[model samples]
Target: MSNPAVSNPAASSRRAARAAVAAPPPRPTSAQASPRPVAALSTRVPLGRRVAKKAFPPAVMLAVASLLVGTSVPANALFDPDAPPASMALSSIADAKVAETVEVEGQVIEAEAASDIATTAASRDAWTVTSYAEMLRLRYGSTNYSYNASGTGPIRWPFPFAAPVTSGFGDRVAPCRGCSSYHRGVDFDAGYGAPVGAIADGIVTAVGRSSSFGYRVEIEHIINGQKVMSLYAHLIDNSSVLTVGAPVVAGEIVGAVGDTGLSTGPHLHLEIHVDSVPVDPFAWLVANAG
Candidate 1:
């Protein structure tokens, strides 16, 4: 039985073939086996690129967050709820100053305007007065006028004693040594010591002596808003019963007619003035006497 294993070659060969198929592969020599497939350096490059790709986004995000924190503006600098901005505060002060300046300028302008208006009004008034004066000179041929209060309507006859007219008002040859070339008043031959009365309601303005007409009395009257003056001259000595500023009514006795300065005989010299200009007493009496 032991010799049977050695004596059959074909069987032995078959066993050998089976063992060879069942055995593991032999270790290779250094020269005979290809080097172990080395991982390529390029492959490591892809891995590095992948790692960088994953880390890069986080790094960029962190850097951006830091930049935002560093460059961020403070809320108080632009929009503070408790306090105004510096520029706004300065603007408010500037506006206040401008308003004050405007107010002052407006006041000055108003004052100047008021002054101009007053000046214009005064100039107009002066011109009116001058024109009125010129008109009186042209119409009356004289500038002597007077103001008086003659009752509401027409004037009254001046004499207390009825007398005829002795002399009329107008130009005439010199009647006496001291008489004017042009007669300015009318004369009534009332005889000596005749009672002289006021022509209208008036206040005595003057009581004095004159070289031309002795012992004169002047009374002022207003009639129809016009001023008038009455004159009584050549009065008797110590005959005046009224003083200056005394009120007198029409027909009230003022003095007595007599021969005084510049008179040829005993008479009453009467004159009328409109706004200081002498007018014809006879004409005035004829037109205005009640």
Candidate 2:
């Protein structure tokens, strides 16, 4: 193989060139070797991005991780720097020990009782959400409205306290624009949503809404060997007892005080009819109720 190629000068030169092209260069020593550039970056690239792309030393990376952990600990409770891939929720609740307070053993500590129940009149009313003196004075001149008299019957007043009466039965100056001058019922200025109870134990005769009465309930009872009909008007529409023949006992909450009919404000318009004749409730309740 060498005989013809070695002898010819042109062929020899061609063989030497081929050998140089085919053979790899000698390996460089550690001293001779130079570090390679990571990438060729443009000046237009963001400084932060360029820095992020470049490799960092172990100490610098460790410092960065430490800073992240310190800052994120408060913001993220589950953050963990030691565990692989950082912190995440544990697989099971049994992985962590329960707190002494959370898992109570024995001897439960009871809370302290309230100190004092009594307070100032204004504070007491504010706390209980009850107000009346001012409203009564402005509406009916004084706070007293004359429902305080007691009688010895199975009947009970609608309100537990002495409620203010705005108008009496018979005749009065029209209270509202469309109100009747000849008033037939007694208006009790019980506060809004105040419970209205049945006057006596009786059977409900009527339960409906009308323009004249506006959400009223009528009950029939035999009082003192006389047929007395009691009508509770200006009541909230959602009355508890709706059945006609429902037997109601005295002092049971039948309806709530409201402003539904031809009225001015929240009150209960109670009308008592003795043998179909309208009578003054004040005179009757004073005479009958004990």
lDDT of 1 by residue, 162-250 (tens): 46776567655566777775778888886798888888899999887888779989999997688999999999877997999999888
- TM value for model 2: 0.49
Best by lDDT: 1
- The superposed Cα distance between candidate 1 and the true structure at residue 17, in angstroms, equals 99
Q: Count the backbone clashes (under 3 Å) in each candidate.
A: 12, 4
TM-score of candidate 1 against the unseen true structure: 0.46
Query: Residue 116 error for model 1, in Å?
Result: 78
Instruction: Report the poorest 10 consecutive residues by lDDT, candidate 1.
Output: 143-152
- The global C-alpha lDDT for each of the candidates, from Candidate 1 onward, is 0.76, 0.73
Model 2, global lDDT: 0.73
